[model samples]
Target: MTPGSGLEQHPLLPWLALQHTRGIGPVRAAKLLEQLGPRWFLSPRLPDCGLSEAQLVQLLTPSWSVLEPLLEWQRQGPARHILSWDHPAYPELLKTLSGAPLLLFVEGDPDALSLPQLAVVGTRHPSYVGKENTRNLVTQLVDVGAAITSGLAIGVDGLGHQAALERGGVTLAVLGSGLEQCYPKRHRRLAGDIVDGGGALISECYPWEAPQAHHFPRRNRIISGLSLGVLVVEAAERSGSLITARFALEQGREVFAIPGAWQNPQAGGCNRLIQQGAKLVCEVNDILEELVAFSTAALKIHPPATEELLPYPDLLDNVGLETTAVDLIASRCQQPVQEVVTRLVELELAGWVESVPGGYVRARRS
Candidate 1:
């Protein structure tokens, strides 16, 4: 049946009812489905299903008002789809999770959901090094036919998606908000680019649901659930990226972390994860080695080429890993402030040093 058909007899109505029914969460709903099968929704009597009276009433008399927006959104375009648990396009890996969403509002290619994905997640305000690491690793992961998966947040998540697109690879972005209301607002174009590049933007929330603080942590599960493994480039000791790593561990997916300088706060969670047995990722092979078994594609390792000597060696030498003030750098290089500023711009474009708040620091190279 077409999605635009009347709601009263819609095939997906029961699934929607089950999803919105009070007290019938994913876990309990899964149990009910297992015991009664898909036909349970049409059954006249639901004996031994263990649902409360209120839940049964809600399921039997669904609030069609709550589901209208979803139907309208799906009818708007062919690329858009609302996938129920039994839908062929619904991801099997995500289905294995304990609290998997009953419906996924997807925009773009639903087939991308089935691709072998490697999740790359990290801090929203990642350091310069963290940004570089995310881009380089995501690019390499895409080369090996691994689709990148990440939340569409601003920092590392955005970088991962952009890198995958730039490398001409597929990337999936799971959202904390509804598909209609892209979170962070800034990455809305990135979200569209994902679709244009043959990827997808996914959300379990209804089309109108706004982003909430709790939705993000909940969103992390799908990121890990859809992937063969998760690579955490940089995260604080208490970061959302670590939450995705924890979910990866619980889901029996490999967890990989990059070691960072001890002083770097963003690396704390990764270091801790390594101590707790997450594989330490120095190069792409570190992750590829663990996930090769999951993919049919042959592995290809591309070693990084040698670093070329950066111009303005005297000025470059003055820029340390820590944020170095432009004035301080100029003083150390014994050059005028204007000359140093011009040279620093060149250095930045050449991938030598990056301008951060208060100064410049050497860019981390792969």
Candidate 2:
């Protein structure tokens, strides 16, 4: 039913009520559905539905206040939809996870969920090279006719969605906040662009719900659950991108990572993944090679072989894992101070060396 269409007799109002109930989570909702089926709300009493006493009351007393905004949101656009778990169009991949969302509030074409997806995730504060790598990788992935999916935050996530849109490929932005609340506020325009470009803006929260710290980690599961594989471009040792990688592993999806300069804090998690046996992706082919069974077109796309090079090979030899003074590095390399500074800048961009307070440190070379 369209939002604001008919609250009085809408078939889904009761289900919405159950969703809005304070203590009735997906597990409890599932238990109730099992006991009472689709029309579980019609049952006179909740004693046998496995709901706690307070939850039973909350469910019985439907909250029009909480349900009204959702309906209003639906009324705002024809593309918006509230998908119940039983909706035939609900994503099969997500349904396989335990305690999956009972209702998915979607904006844009829901059919995009049926297409093959690859999740690209990384840090919010990516280095310049990390951002460029993400954009290029996303472009190649889209060429193979797969929908890109990400959390839609800044850095790599936003870059992935933007690349897909620029290439006219479908992408999905799964939000940590409500569709109406668009977290970070700056991405509000980006969110609109996604829906306008035939991509999607999705949420499991109410339309007006504000973002919380916990929402993002919960949101990560959905990103991995919806995709055939996940690629971590760059992330810190303790970044949330690693959490998404863990979720992908748990969901039985392939995990891919690009090894970066060892000195890059952002590359720490990705390097660790490579050490732990995640596919070390140097090019899109590394990802496509694993996804051949998932997307036949991937086999047709011939990505160039991976290339690894040092911008200034000699400069790095003078730098070590420990910080070394600029003058000392220049003296050791036998290069002029001005030349050394220029080379250091170039090496940093190549993710080979990082400038420290006193001088520079060499990053791990893969």
Candidate 3:
């Protein structure tokens, strides 16, 4: 059924209750629903469904107070919606997963979930090249009629959404917190833009639930699950983006990674994924060719641009993957400390190097 259709009957309550019910997580809930069907809440067989007595009691007499905020939030606007497992608007791609969310709180076009999506995820501190790659790929993906999906994070995630919006393409932001409590506090505006741009902001958390550390890993699954595939723009050896890529693999969704230079730490995760059998993507067609159904038309392929020479080669050579002190770099280059600092700033702006806590490190190679 469509959202807001059965609000008075509170059809979503049972799903929400099942969600908050202790000991019955998404996997168990999905299995139970699979076995007993949507009307299982009223069945006499609930006692035989493997739930403990206390769990059964909690399900039978769900705390209405706990669910009021979500219900109220949905009522506040026509755009806001709550999708139960049985809802027609629940994304079909996500439903195939074993541990799919019981309920989805959506704040935008629910139909956007049904569109072909490619998830773009990466580090929070992306290199300038990483940002450029994300924007360039997203722009072309938009041209191919694919929706961009990502966590509403600061670096790559935010850039993906912004790029899609700038291209006037649909994008979805899966959140680690409730719809009301936009995490990072910085992307709240971007979240609004997603909704305003005919995209969506989605979350499985309760309306007022704060973002906890554990919430993000679970959030990653939704990002991957909702998409046809996931693209790792730039990630470290250990990153949440890798978790999303892992989920994409388990979900049977195609996984794509952009190869990065060996010396770039941010590119380490992508390189690792390529080694592990993820399709190495160099352009939009690499993805479109795999998800053939999403390709709308042939793209005008362009030749690769000539790589520019690295400015201040001597100064850059002094910087390494590990943070190198400015003084050490100056001594190595035999330049004054002030001159070294000025050139370093130019290098940083050029995306050749970045300043870190200890000093400077090489940024991603283009």
Candidate 4:
């Protein structure tokens, strides 16, 4: 996974060389790549660098000791490869964002990071209601075949992962900490579950980097950047969830907000997003319709299985009928209510029926 090994060029090598240099940050590294390339650290270039005369002294300074750990790291293996902006594997969506991570030290499946993604984000300290809302909506979205992405922090993020797993879908966990350490210690098991279930655990931080305060806002940007849109399930006025919404706005990705009861303090930020014109999400269809319209493709959804249903009729013939209750349908079909409920769920997912207040309504066929 050494970046650009199979390609004709490695633009990031020059950038990473500077990244390994002390006193050079993203702005400086980008400047160096534009000027002397990675050689900026080795050779001396004054005019090519935008650095003022005073800045040149600092820029020219050497810090080989700072690179000792990195050199040793490079010798280890493909299990870790540092990715810079120019790596072919670097996501195209990520390239459009400002200050994409200078290096991505990835674990699990790196390919999953490049998929067309929709980020599901919300409050880390979610209320009970918030968790349920996240689970239901995420399940619906996954059912329609959109991959779930989130910063695998606690609360709503963890719930989204669980729901996607239950729905037999893929999810990506963007970490605020390093690959080696799982934050919230409680989610160590859940993190394993995510990787075991065909998703990935991702981070840009180097090994053993702890979840510091500064890391999360930076992490928030990646959560938004990797997504076609971001769903904010719930958030307080000043919560970190707002950071992701802000990044989504700045990154030009769609920002979706789920409205909740005004009586709940946790709903404040999402309510504000709605007033400010973020989509007011009520169901997964609301999201899928918008997504399919934007992406200009039909959702890759598979129909539910027969055994998972109640052995009802060819549901198409049952279309355009009056609404019917689960209990009544069970009696009509001579099946248990649970079986009837399952069939109705399958039909509803297939878009042949819509769940009404007290019953299921058949969709009118054209």
Segments of candidate 1 deviating more than 4 angstroms: 1-5, 43-45, 297-366
Q: List, residue by residue over 143-184, the lDDT tens digit for candidate 4.
A: 677778998888888889889988998888888888677877
The TM-score of candidate 4 is 0.70
Encode model 1's per-residue lDDT on 241-296: one tens digit a residue: 99999989999999999999889999999999999999999998889778656564
- Worst lDDT window (10 residues) for model 4? 1-10
Q: Which ten residues in a row have the lowest lDDT in candidate 1?
A: 296-305
Off by over 4 Å in 4: 1-13, 20-24, 27-47, 52-81, 297-366
Reference-based lDDT, residue 138, model 1? 92
Of the candidates shown, which would achieve the greatest lDDT relative to the real structure?
3
Stretch of 10 with least lDDT, candidate 2 = 297-306
Q: How many backbone clashes does candidate 4 have?
A: 0
Per-residue error for 240 in candidate 1, Å, reads: 0.8
Count the clashes in each prediction. Answer: 0, 2, 0, 0
lDDT of 2 at 255: 99
lDDT of each: 0.88, 0.85, 0.89, 0.73
Query: Which scores greater on lDDT, model 1 or model 3?
Result: 3
Task: Return the candidate ranking by TM-score, descending.
Answer: 1, 3, 2, 4
Each candidate structure's TM-score, on Cα atoms with residue i matched to residue i, is 0.78, 0.74, 0.77, 0.70
